[model samples]
Target: MHEKDHSEALKARIKSPKRASRRMSMLLGAVALGALTTGAMLQSSFDVGPTPAYAQNLSAQVPAATSAGFADVVDHVKPAVVSVRVKVAVEGASAEGFDLRQFGLPEGSPFEKFFRRFGDEGQRPAPRRYGEAQGSGFFISADGYVVTNNHVVEKAREVEIQTDDGKTYSARIVGTDPKTDLALLKVDAEGGFPYVSFARNAPRVGEWVLAVGNPFGLGGTVTAGIVSARGRDIGAGPYDDFLQIDAAVNRGNSGGPTFNAAGEVVGVNTAIASPSGGNVGIAFAIPAETVQKVVAEIKEHGAVRRGYLGVQIQPISKDIAEGLGLDDAKGAIVARVEGGSPAEKAGIKTGDAILAVDGHEVKNARELARDIAGFAPGKSVDVTVWRDGKKREISVTLTKMPGEKTASAETGEEQGGKLGLSLAPASSVDGADKEGVVVVGVEPGSPAEERGLRSGDVIVSVGGKKVETPQDVREAVKELRKEGRKAVLMQVESANGARFVALPIA
Candidate 1:
């Protein structure tokens, strides 16, 4: 029924939902006038109608936002949003190039080669390829500074933005942070630009939000929804603390602004969790808290300078907590302390559980990483860690994170009895440990394998003590169990990096 029918029905549902009997004044949510490019609407008008008395009663009971309305909010913020267009260079080619085929337009079509002749003034640049992409962004200052996604301008050679009023202006990339997928752009005209500010607080779950963007290159479209959740980690990066919203964000909505009822930008629309590229009501946005910080740094330095404490870490599991005598499975267990890093200088060793930083409780590895990164480099803070059944505070002065790397591990397999781990001295194994027992193998379905120990993982320490041989590991484990501990913690170094694993001594 699609193509024509699909366009007709979508128009109907959006433009003319059923009315109530109580004579409610209708507010047209949004209009995409003359916006249909790929298709046109044949059935342009709908038959007017009224609903039963029950429909009126139900409508009355609904929230009064119908009366308060989003039109005011939309009017306040829509002008700040612009449709950003960029001539993106081909993957490897210079920014002054384009590959039309790679632009994700009409795939498998002959237009690929025909579009290459996009030369104006009888001058075709070199044989390099170029493509164009469009997304949404908003001005954040009266000086014409715009905030958008890093992906919108990454590898962009020429950038221009068309405002809601159809006026286009050339823009320059001010700065970009790919880790947060946020980019700042500057329009260099002398006139003051209409702009919006970031919301001081994140929107609460179920709070109303309006997403304004240029979907499918359609100008200044608006959709309404509520905040679905917060602190969502979509694995986009180590700093991923996205706000989940059930909004109709689409492809061109990337880098657009999601505003609160007060017309303040609450989030920057980023990734959509949909199987097909279209929106399925599950979209993630970068919270404005992150945006304000990142944009501020970008404005000041033209790059984000994040505090670094170079320690590879993993979340504390229940078994690991029990092994370390922790009351709860919280905090991040330091796996490997990078040489010369703040963690190393602070005497933070492998197997230390980082419980808090500057009195802020770190609930997990991601939080700890994010918290540390939030600080400026050269900032000194107190990091609390649990070691040897006690908590101690260590002062660390952070340095600029050279390059961000978050620890992620995938398990593999065979091995022994007892703890289901076959162990040998590091000296006996090729390319093995200088100060620990090497895992020769892991038994399938055993505790060792379940806890993610692999054949090549060098067990560096048992029960907080460094072990050079398999016999030393056994002795340490036996001693820890003799103290009535149900689990033993071992520092194991794998190819990914060093991490702590808890194996049941029982």
Candidate 2:
């Protein structure tokens, strides 16, 4: 691949401006999109297809009178973009029981009268306030509906929206979906207003895109880039299907929209990867397809309702794949099935390798979880699993995830001298004194002692689920042995912090 001129419309959108008054949001968008497009073209240049055409036409028509360039797209979308400001009230320390006036207050009077003279009663100094944060958002509907990131409005007591024209409107939260970091707000505008429409299809790889948002409270900033990658999982949540771009999304750009060349909203700028809190070119956006679904759901219902498949799952590692006689590790491996839950009803069990759901391939447990949760409860779906070296299909009705429940603690008598290490329940400590199996006694030459298993460490989870007692540890070990897995990943919380330790169960 040849180096394209940075100003060849494709690269010009990403170059930094001469002054420091630069908009990080737009810059990061361009960088991310450029990276995405370059990677896609490298893999399959001829596969650019019609997607870029849809994107290019929108970008190419720069207004000639304005020295036609990327800013033209910015001008077209700026009116609909707005800055959201939030204020929060913080509570101060309470003097609940103490009474300074007790030494001299009137006998029958409550402390009110004495405290009033100090002006702390009737004029209770306004609660200490904190957040006065600003972020970017755009109108999604002509009827004054807007979309932004949930983090942009989180904990905000009052939200106000300010357009590029300096007019501000008081906005109310319509709904929010934290799983996707998206929120919807409304303003009471009298008539139709400028708004951006969502693209009917997902933005194709290598397509030009633009981002508009407020960065550092600077209003109505715009940047352009191309789609660098898709279906990126940065571990933000189980449902991470982020569109990676070279567009510069920085702080304050969290809630802005990314548009295709046709001026249609294609992505919602959410995050960027930069150590200095400025755009370094890598950014991520929530795809417009997911945004449309989430926004519509929030508008209809006050909250999101996701389906649940009750089972503990993990990605199939290479060792496990070879042990199971598989070609490669490319699916989710079921570790445990909830009794009487959907997995059990569908004849799914521990050690089953899940290949796909309803014909859509699942690359890992997180992908499977996200796909399943996209559906509503009681919906029937077909699951493909690899068991005993063959594929099988099972139909199951999804259920809701049960509320969090505490597991019983595992207690055991100190067993020492067997494993070269001392082991005991981690009790009587400041943090884990309440309920942790401790490692008390270690023999100098045992494997446990060699592995550095200490006395004060509290085992919190075995194989990713909380284990309350030592008996739970035994059960997990037994199950792992039965499944033929060699190691059990244990999450141990110590006074210092939490760390994962993979203990050999076989």
Q: Pick the candidate with the highest TM-score.
A: 1
In the range 191-295, model 1's lDDT, one tens digit per residue, is 667777777677899998989898777778999999999997655555668888887887788889998877788899977765445667877889887888778
Against the true structure, candidate 2 reaches a TM-score of 0.61
Off by over 4 Å in 1: 1-68, 91-126, 404-506
Question: Quick one: how many clashes does candidate 1 have?
Answer: 9
Off by over 4 Å in 2: 1-67, 91-130, 404-506
The model with the greatest lDDT is 1
What is the C-alpha RMSD, rounded to one decimal, of candidate 2? 19.1
TM-score against truth, every candidate: 0.62, 0.61
**C-alpha root-mean-square deviation, each candidate:** 23.4, 19.1
- Determine which window of 10 residues in candidate 1 has minimal summed lDDT: 14-23
- lDDT for position 258 in model 2: 90
